[model samples]
Target: MGLPARRPHAPAEGRARGQGGRVMAPFPKIHDLYVSRMVVMTVLLTWTVLVGLDVVNAMISEFGDVGKGNYGLLDAVTYIVYTIPRRAYTMFPTVAVIGALMALGQLAASSELTALRALGLSRRRLSLSVAAPLLVLTALMMVNGETLGPWGQRSADGMKTAAKSKDMAVAQFSGLWAREGDIFLNAQNGQEHADGKDTWLELDDVRLFEFADDGRLESIARVATAEHRKSGWLLRGVKRTYFEGNSVTQTEVMEEHWTSQLDAAALAASASNLWRPRYMSARDLRDGINYRKRNGLDASEFEEHYWGRWFYPLNVLALCLAAIPFAFGTLRSGGAGKRLFIGIVFALGFWLLQMQFVKLAGVYRFDYRIAYLMPPVVMLGVSAWLFRRRSG
Candidate 1:
């Protein structure tokens, strides 16, 4: 009585028995690594295409300015090159969502997603796997925004300024010219300083030229250092020369209160690249917020950008998740071009929605953080509802 034949061990779970009784290979593991690679490759491809178009448009616009001052074609090209990092940083969120949608769309088109689902991988699980790579990319983009993006923007700005002006030169270590009424101001150099939790801008070798109504130079004041204080601008080590009929009278003072309508914010923005809240890092934004608050100035705009920066990752991921549902159902049978069109429309709609929320916040004077948060929160809710419906 021979031993009963084992039932071929039930094909060992994922293993399949062929006609010749040879066990076939198990289905390839579709873990985070495999999904992440697909998503990342698609994202890179999409980013390249989108960024290339954007750069070309920018080059065309920049080329129009080539003949202005000493700004030749080479200068225009150089300026565009310097700004690419910032452009990449700015476009990444849009690129990420579109890329993710295209990736999943391809998978669904190939029926790989159906296979994954049949193998016990839920849509939620696949969504997470896709998000993992984007999370890493978000972190990398944050760093790029802080470092290369701002640096490149500043360099581009400086290069353009230098090429466009002979007497007025702008650089990190150089100076910029600003005017208020008949008075022209120049700061030989400026630097941002941080003292504990407080931050401020200090200008060195400050010069102010006050012109008379008749176009005659009334007086020239020179200061060693100029600082913006809550009270007003404070000029230290001041020397003033009055030019009346070619007989100059010089007066020296240890300190003087500068009176002018020149905006401190504008000065900071022009003097240092770090002061532009739009391009500033989280740390710089925080410092700017603190400084504005301490000075009793309006900090709403800074707060808006600060909260926006912090919520960037959440917003991007939520949008991507919301976009994923489009790849399933009817879209599964659709062409890749159709999916891409849908992704673009979705991204544009989301951007418009976000802009509306921001505008509403400004109109109603609500907490800017709430404004920044609502879009992502709405996206996440929508995603969850769609996923639940699909799963059901």
Candidate 2:
């Protein structure tokens, strides 16, 4: 018999197929880029709309107080501008889901997804492509939240306080309370300086109440100005009052070297809603927790906030991923508005559940780490199962 002739490979087939003779590469760069770009643009537009709505609502809410004190319309606008980053961080997860869903729904509606499926792109690969750009966005958001959000929030709050009350500008309470071993510390006013490693707090009118082992008041020290030094606190113009049986004695000193373990981290961490945990960076939260823990202070709140902020991006990505199946399955044939509305509904529910969980955790003394991780884990789990079922 004659030798069997070898057939030449088709040029089109060679170019279109993978090395293993599949119709698609493991990761198609052009397809991934196209999907990523579409998703990113949709997300940006959706996020802008959400932010605008929020801004309008905020302006309306603050309009009532616009003329009060020195807080004019301009001040309100400035305050909104300053706090934009924080708001963006807070609303990111919701807008991310809405945007991704809208993008996927659009593609499905246009039969682009069908074509991709025909080209041998699996759901898993497509999901990853959609997730890639969002991961980058989440990282950028982390940076913005850590750097710009805190600084801007602090400045806006100071401006609002100064406009509202004279005491707030100089001698008002910082709403910070901390316990260091046997001593309890409180500050009427404090200023934060720009120091990356140590959040320097320059306290004005600080009060230190000391207690004995029996929980009796031992003494009270009042300082006009207090700054955290390497060794301890440098208290200027200190007045010490002794609470002894049947005799109360008072002494004053030009300056005193106070030995205490509390630092700027503790003060900033203990600040009330004005300095919320979401504003602090990971490093800030870690340092604060360590300082407070080392000083025999409770760090539960800081730990909770730290974990929540640290897992923020992951939580958002999970929610977005979880939302993909809805866009492709039931909502695939729906209009963009329909998908967006559904996304909003889901986002609102997620926020409500998150808030409720946090509140319940605080009441029940649940583990902060678990409380922070619960939402993301559940979201991702559901997403994985859905994708598996759909693909199977």
Candidate 3:
């Protein structure tokens, strides 16, 4: 035996091989890069399609407002364009699911996933590979939401309002809520009124609840209208009720001058569609909460808004992770359209559940942090369970 026939171009006995005793390319970097590319590409494509549909729908809904005041067709288009970032922030999580599911489904359909598995790639590893790019995207979206989203939304609303009226004011479905040193105020409506040398913010049906340092209600002031003057706010047609031990004293005044720290600039900054929490940055939310706390007013709503904004990226990640198992199992053989449909259905369900939880939390007066975090925690738990089951 001539020292055993030497095999040409054959891998050594101890070397790892692919189906045969032949050398194979390193799968980790190659597969990871490939999977990341597929996910990112699909995400971009899905996001583009969804944004296009959203733009068309927005145009149709807003077109009726065209030609109102100075708001022409061009103005409407500009308003819609400016709001694209905000809408994209709202739609990101849905597209993340759709994109990841479609990409993985495509790979499964083509047997690429099967090949990767045969090459000793674990499902958990594959999941992480897919998640890495999504995590980066979530961070980017958070930045956009904090900066461009709010700015654009405010600018668009201001443009539309300015076009419609000389006074720049955005209509809110509910009303405006604000706070000063000791006064918590709710204005049913607000508009700017410019007269010669001065511009004033005219607030209608204003209610002010004055609180003491001990968190006791000192008095309630109801004004038919309040106007911002250079010196201070002038409340007209005022009815004030003082809260004392066991007895309440009520007095009516034709007009009273209200003095406080809240001014035109502060009110202008907070002037937004107040039916919902304003799209405030984390810093703004924190300062608002602190101001409310210092004034001995309830900061529950601000707390909720703060946590919701602060933890947005985590919530998005949880939602995206939850969709992975569905991609690998139910949608393994499905096409991109099927994946898209399923992703939409699931995304809608998630949104409904999240809204319900938030509302219920408010009704029950639960902790704001808990209320904001509950949905993401549940999603993360479900994902973990499904991932373990699949891996096991």
lDDT of each: 0.79, 0.76, 0.78
List CA RMSD, all candidates.
9.2, 11.2, 11.6
Residues 1-392, candidate 2: write the lDDT tens digits: 99999996553324567677776544547888899999999999999999989988988887886876788989998988888898888788998999999999899989898877766566776888899999999999889888887777777776765565432331122544556788877675444555767655666667888999999999999888788766677899899999999899999999888777664553553344344455666777787688667756556667778888877887788788888877557676878789888788878877776777777787788887777677777778888898887767
- TM-score (C-alpha, index-matched) for candidate 1: 0.73
* Model 3: lDDT of residue 147: 88
Question: Per-residue lDDT of 1-392 in model 1, one digit per residue for the tens?
Answer: 99997864331323455777654534334455677789999999999999999999999999887987899999998988988888888898899988998888888889888877766565766887889899999999888888888788777877776676543445544457777788888886565667888777787778999999999999999998889876788999999999999598999999998776666665675576434568766776787678667756566767878888888888789889888887778578778788788888878888898889988998899988888888888888888898888878
Candidate 1: lDDT over CA atoms? 0.79
Looking at candidate 2, what is the lDDT of residue 370?
78
**Lowest-scoring 10 consecutive residues by lDDT in candidate 2?**
164-173
Q: How high is each candidate's TM-score? A: 0.73, 0.71, 0.70
Q: Which residue pairs does candidate 3 place in steric collision?
A: none
Query: Which scores better on TM-score, 1 or 3?
Result: 1
Candidate 3 residue 248 C-alpha distance from true site, Å: 37
Runs in model 2 with CA error above 4 Å? 1-28, 170-273, 291-298
Best by TM-score: 1
